[model samples]
Target chain A: MKASPMVEIKNLKKWFPMKSGFKSKSNLKAVDGVDLHIYGGETLGLVGESGCGKTTIGRTLIKIYEPTDGEFLYRGGDSSEGGVDIFSLSESKMRPFRREIQMVFQDPYASLNPRITVHDIISEGLRVHSMGKSREERKSMIAGILEKVGLRPEYMYRYPHEFSGGQRQRIGIARSMILNPGLVICDEPVSALDVSVQAQVINLLEDLKHDFGLTYLFIAHDLAVVKHICDRISVMYLGRIVETAETDQLFDNPLHPYTSGLLSSIPVPNPHMRKIGKREIVKGDIPSPVDPPETCRFVKRCPRAFDRCCKESPSLREVSDGHFVSCFLYD
Target chain B: MPKFFYKRKLDEIEEKARPVHINSYRQLVWTKFKSHKLALFGAVVLIGVAFFTLLGPLFVEVGYEDMDFSNLFSPPLTEGHPFGTDELGHDVLVRVMYGGRISLFVGFASAVITTLIGTIVGLLSGFYGGIVDRLLMRFVDVMLSIPMFPILITLTLVFGSGIMNIILVLTVFGWMGVSRLVRGLVLSIRETEYVMSARAMGVRNGRIILRHVLPNVIPIVIVSATLNMSYAILAESSLSYLGLGIQPPMPSWGNMLQRAMNYILGTTTGTNPWWLTVFPGFFIFITVLNVNFLGDGLRDALDPKFVSES
Candidate 1:
């Protein structure tokens, strides 16, 4: 924790304004208040159920959705500036920093520009950043990065429609990594690919991470895939981070009731274990994010919730070394 | 330093040695378009008709405005005139060919103007998607609600009837449909991941729209443009029939058709001069039909789902 963090997000909030009748407005608190740090060259997995704002956190960090409040900082490899206050910087001023941080989108089908050739799609980042001296240099760089991401060099000549789901994801990966960004936010990079191809893409990502010295904020709803690639894990519920811990530590000892419920839901493969294991399935649809209550967001859904859980909200508290949880049980 | 930053000499050498697969997206779309038999036929018809409209008049010696009182209502293959002469003794072939130029010009000019204005407005409205979208889309709705024909007639009356005025009026009314169409496309394109990824990569907003959003919308634009041209021609013809478009001494298929209307009663009497109405009316029909066919072909060829599914 003492080592200088590569990216630090402090109580970042993003609320989308919704029109409510005439002359009134409401806020959908997609990412209310989130705080986390990703160290250099580490893969931090942001995990939550489908509407829990995991994607919002990744987007907010990349400045896709401007932060509503709080400080967001990025410790650039060039340490002389200390840390750039990303949220404070104007969009024009933030442009240069964008080249240092890129994103690999979730849906490979929708990620690559279908109208463009694979070369243009992958090299678009390079062309935008004005990375190389000439178009030829960028072409060479694209070919090199394409090969690095496990695609053939000549494949760049083809359009996205010509490739399968896995090949398209590789093209998406090459695009993000082409600029050699310090932080690459992979928003469910393999969720759209086949199970067999998912492992190949995951392994390719791991290989690229080492070869490029890239740090990642991998967002996924699936715990098993997150476990395979992420070094650390942060669990989110509603619009807040309920727990954050080392991946193995969080799996071994889940502090929050929500975390335990999530872990218990993972289907055990063995027949005997499946028969004997009692699955913890929470009931009821997630409450609306519009004007959420002051109490714990998960109170109505938490199986172990008590009187105090209804009255107060829990802040993320360090229960053990590098293990943090937001439940009153931990406190 | 990471190996990707600086290109290795070996990598460059290997790049040159590798088997090159140079299949560009333009080539792919073209190849697909070529495979569509109907689209190919439509393309040929469109090109052939356009060429005839442009150059067919040059080969004929008789002027469209020249009148020969002695040759009035002459049938086809008459001396010193081909395709016969009209009731006014004007050469039907020359007038029809000349009308093609004006009709085709008005169609294309208005379509281009509409597409340009519509693309800009739609891109701005859809990409920004806030008050701008609300204002532009509402304006489109207002435009859509008005009776276009009445407004066009009123505008042409105020503006004076001429080819440019007709083009301007048609353009003013025509752009709304394209804007609405482009706006719808942009709304979806703006949400796609590549756009967000482009935004995250430090690409300027304008570049994202041009490079990512516009290219995706081009196929739709092409198809719409062809359809728009046919609509423009039809509108121009209707206006001319009402005497609000393309005045006399000038040849427009619309005005020519209006002139032909005078000869329709001749048919009831069994004395009809079929050359006047049939030839101009036939040209209008064939031109519109061919353009529409081309539009249909483009829509099929450019549909990404159609391409991938096949």
Candidate 2:
């Protein structure tokens, strides 16, 4: 592992102002004060339920949605001392950084523009960044990338609608990878694919990561898929990271109550072991993120809630080597 | 599964299956448009009419101002007067051909101007939502609320009636509908994932609007422009009928109709000059109808989901 992290997020906040009625305004704290680090050449899976600000974090990191507050520092390659804060950079100043970071979207169908051919879609980034010198050079580069992503080079001239879900996903992958970005924010890339196709895409992604030496902030809701690909995992609940550990360590000895509950919900493949395995399903709906109380976000849904869980929120603390948890039980 | 054998077989199969030519976006739209039979017919008819009117004047020797008092009220096929002569002994065929030039010019020019203004305003308003959108939409609403014909008449009267002044008046009121339509379309398109993806790629805002949003908007703008052209023609006709558009001897289709209406109740000779009114009115009707058909065809052809086979 490298001594320095490739990217470090410090106290990130993204609050969207909501209009309730006339003369009253409140903010929905979508991603409130998230602190994280993504090291070089490793997939860090961000596992969370729907609307837990997982996608928001990914978007904010790439400057898709500007952060309400905090620092997003990108330290490219081995030399880490001279990294710039992404949040403070102006749009023109940030253009070059955009070439270094790319994203694969959730929906394959919606991601590619319908009117344009696959060649145009893949070449868009190259055109913007002025990667290839000439049109023919860009065409060859696009063809090469298409083959790398497992799509035929001949498929470049076809429109997006001509392809199936899996093929379109490959095109989406090709589009992002063509830029040779250092860090890829794969925001639910496989969530919208078929169960059978998911494995293929996952393997493709894994192969590409090794081939390109790319780091990934893999945001997903599926723990099983995340465990397969991610080197380390971070469990988020309501815009806050509750636990961070190695994939096997997090799954085998889950520390936070929320993390354990998530792990238990994954169905076991063996019927014989199912009866023996205990399911610690948490109770109650996720609390509204709009002006949430200062108490622990998981207190209402925690299976082992205590007096301290309601009165005060617990910040993440290291309990074991390479494992951190936020629940008061560990404290 | 040997590498050489597998690669050779795959290459052979791919070569056999590959299409000979790749279709560009324009080619696809043209192919789809050609499939719509009615629109194709309309296009042919419109082209024929345009060519005849625009070029027919060159062949005809009779000028619009050349009045023959001796050949007054002469019906169709009467030496040198094929369609007929009007109360002023002016050749109706020459007059109709000349008038078409004015009417068609007004329609095409106004449509182009309105579409340009509407598209620019709508693109800006829709892409930059918030105060800009609210302010633009409200201004559109204010423009829409004003009575169209009354303002058109007032403006025409103020500017003095001519081809340019009438077109100017029509354009001022005409752009509002197209802007509203384009804004609605842009609002939806701006939220699409492709646009967001483009933004994430750090494609500049102007480039995104032009390359991404504008292409999607063009189909709608084209259809609306066709509709606007027909509307402009009719508006011109109505204003001229009321003696407020394209005044007198310059002979527009509208003013021609205005002059024909004077002889509808029969002239001093007790002869009904129905030929005078029928020819100009028929031209207007055909032009508008075909323009509409062309618009309908374009809408279907431009739709990305429209299957050419269907």
Candidate 3:
């Protein structure tokens, strides 16, 4: 990255307790020992299969869920800044930290409030963090942001119910960007949307990044969508990053068998890369987060597993200058 | 499974012409409700009775408790009194109208207050989901354990009977059930993606609870409040009938019933004079029913949980 690292994840772990009513919970490691660097003005895509803990990683980095163990450092120098190990800070201390980071969620239908007018929905972040000094300032700022997201200023008075799904997702974007956050986690932002609208939103995101100098940890399962937008991509499996490489490098020659399998599975019409007669069909569902294997998690599904793979959980080693992978094959 | 399948098919056929938003829930309910022949008749009868009772007495001169012993029991359609005189010689028509106003007032007032209080408590408890929830829900549980009749009687015995006092008690405990309702609503709504987005935006607790959570709970609250009004009105009348609700001279619907009970019992209560009990009883029934219809229609119109009307 040309720019400095805006956010750093150092051995981050998030374990959710598996419990029922009045029952003691067993620890379930949802995000286990994830280390990553997201630099300023860069989009880092965290791609994974379902339940691979990509979403958990996003939530934990923002302190929505405290890490079980690890350090999350913010770039600010404020009293609430510079990585006091967010898990140790009081909730009030975490308040101002919220202004720096925001999230745009998947499911546009579920992300923008139905009862709220587009105005209140968009202006909410501005009002909460005390961004604008006066009502007119807030209004103009809200209108400006709405227009930035491809919405008419007049539609501010209308409730969310009046808008289409894509429009609502735009409003959701407007709400998050009203504060012009430094870091925004777009969690599967286009999955719920139709294919055509997806391109518009992705383009909007790209334009917004250029305008606002934003950094993103775009989490999604579809590598095809993430391929163009992300500067670097980390492919995860069962709560751990299996491979990390620059987007082009990862796409051109995926080394990890899991990454290779994921890339091979993409139903694209690329003629040259086509393996018409061969498909890497991964066996078995993702292993449960509860009581994960002591060895390499990919061992069970790996077609290339060996004796050493069963005895050791591979460390994320730098295979090339910036490329990292966690596989015995690399060692 | 087949029954559900057939019903689902019928719903699909009905849903075909329906708009995507409305077709899912609101329109389906509305079309089904509209098709119900008896509910429609009940709805009309209810509206007519409420219109005449609630609006009819606004034109009369006599006060609700006005008395003139000389004209007592002069019979129905009598001159100077269309509904004739009661045992107290008061104009029964005027009395029932005013009583209707009072009954509707108490019922509506109690229901509204209850819904508001319940919604606030519910949102806080359900959305917060920790010590706050524990304390607030424990309070609700404590309130719920108290028996309705005994509490009303004790309150009447201790604080004395009047409209405001009765409304206060009704609202106090009336909020319990709807609190549970709204809490359940907020529980579901808080987990919704919109709420998550709001939280991610650094939106404060109060704004999220009010804007995102509260609106989602409106359908449930409206439906519950509408039902609660019927209960409130019935409870008030029952209290008055037991001589503990509105004291003598206020002439509540329940007090009206209490006075007419003797006459009905003495005359087998089936005689044409039965209009006394019948009219007041009919007013209570219709007011409750109309409030229900209003709730139903509002549910169809404003409920967001129901699929958007295509």
Candidate 4:
């Protein structure tokens, strides 16, 4: 938690030009004007509704999709200028960046390649980056990484089909961590898992982070899960970060109206604690990202939206130390 | 001590272990495949015969080159002779094995080359979809519609004979049907959440196709490929029969049968041997049937869709 920042994004925007109708071309903004910092040894829990650009932000940070506009800074980890603007470099220069900042994808079932043996899947990153020297050395290193991920070494020869969902996730985690990357974007790492298995994975990730001194950009829609692991949290609304703060601060005293509503809506265990439900309910469905609103992306459904909120798009700004919010009410 | 040793070994193995299934599809399909004794036997026998036929001639000193006129038409299993001698008195069984070399090579090699080309192109075209899919499929359809034989004939007529030429034609034109089959495979496998998960993992498009989509289609390609080789052998035989395939002195079964047809009729009618046509035809039937049987076994073993209700 005391370590310096490892990754930085400045006004990153990712727009997809998807032409759906037989007649017209439509442009959709999947991740627009989002900026956040991930410090080494810290987990940045990015929570939001489905289709709220959580995945997009994670991807943009990883350089899978080129940010349509903005600068991505990577420092002191995987060789991209030790805090260099990642988006500025060509793909040839991005190789080490990819190796250093790996991704533990959301779906364990799909993240690993089914055709390849678990050994090969784990070693593929090593091969591409020329990490380990000999085949035997790579095998040993892969075995070691697999063990670190709580999988037995012999699983190296087995195909992806041989593993259960939890084991498959461990394989995915192993594949990402095989390179011993400093930053791993765990995109909803345990969302696809059974409820009982989620805690085990969370524990495993915590152990791995402590052991390896790894940083995680943990993305999820479940507020409770994110609260469990994330030191700092960010809530997104339609491709924009609505609010960001430390976990305790956000839950204890939510500044953004949306954050407060999300917390109040979480099912409390005690039925006796029930006051008349003054919990703010989000009305209306998520609007299509295509040709989104020019002003506040969530103004139509925001409880505190005013005349100014409708006319102007709020920029992400520091409302307090280590806390940021993008809303005219905060302004 | 042994048990402890084994337990430690098992524990170490388990640490680097795969999640094992207590009950699996193994007992089912594996038994089914083995039960296909004819197919299983065919695979083993054909593999053995093919190994000898293909690799045997390379090692042997005297080939179809050595001619013995006095030994010509010697009845099979004669003194110090087996399967008799031909008109030139060349060793018949040796020539037959050598002939199998050429026939099996042209068949299997062409089929493999064709199937690889088809599956790769089809997987990319179908999985990506849109204008690419339309164009590629249409091209495949056009290639399929054209009479494969005439085109092959024209190609052979232009390119001439030998194993290389035959493999070239088969690879170039033989991919059409396989491409269609692979396109269907890709179309379905692409829908699996696993593939989408790969894309989400930041895996590149090429890597996703090769790693995620291609392996599932391998069983289909493997089965279809063996069958295609059988067809390829027949095509080559027909070419040889028409005097367009492997030129004489190369010792193809088709040319041998062609040369022996007159003698076979003569043996039935007059004094020449009737075994000529019978021998070549027998070899051809056996080779095709064996390859088909192997393919059937593979299909039964690998295809999840073909799981027999036990």
Give the poorly placed runs of model 3, Cα more than 4 Å off.
A2-4, A20-24, A76-93, A268-273, A276-278, B1-72, B87-90, B258-270, B290-310
Question: Weakest 10 consecutive residues, lDDT, candidate 4 chain A?
Answer: A74-83
Cα lDDT listed for each candidate: 0.84, 0.86, 0.79, 0.77
lDDT of 1 by residue, B95-141 (tens): 88888999999998998899999989989999999899999999998
Between candidates 2 and 4, the DockQ winner: 2
Each model's TM-score for chain A is 0.96, 0.97, 0.93, 0.95
lDDT of 2 by residue, B168-196 (tens): 88888889888888898999999887888
Writing each residue's lDDT as its tens digit, candidate 3 over A232-293 gives 99999888888998999999878798998888888867788677866676888898889687
> Considering only N, C-alpha and C atoms within 3 Å, which residue pairs clash in candidate 3?
A110-B194, B19-B310, B20-B310, B21-B308, B21-B309, B22-B308, B22-B309, B22-B310
For A96-215, candidate 1 gives per-residue lDDT tens digits of 788888888889889988877788887777777778888777877777887788887777777788889999999998888888788888888888988999999999989988987889
Best by lDDT: 2
User: Model 2's chain B TM-score?
Assistant: 0.87
True contacts kept of each: 0.59, 0.34, 0.42, 0.19
- Judged by lDDT against the true structure, how good is candidate 1? 0.84
**Candidate ordering by DockQ (highest first):** 1, 2, 3, 4
- In angstroms, the error of model 1 at A85 is 1.7
Residue B240, model 2: Cα distance from true site in angstroms: 1.6
User: In model 1 chain B, which range of ten residues has the least summed lDDT?
Assistant: B16-25
Which structure among the candidates has the greatest TM-score?
1
**For residues A35-100, could you state the per-residue lDDT of candidate 2 as single tens digits?**
788899999999999999999998888887879999988987543585889999999988978888
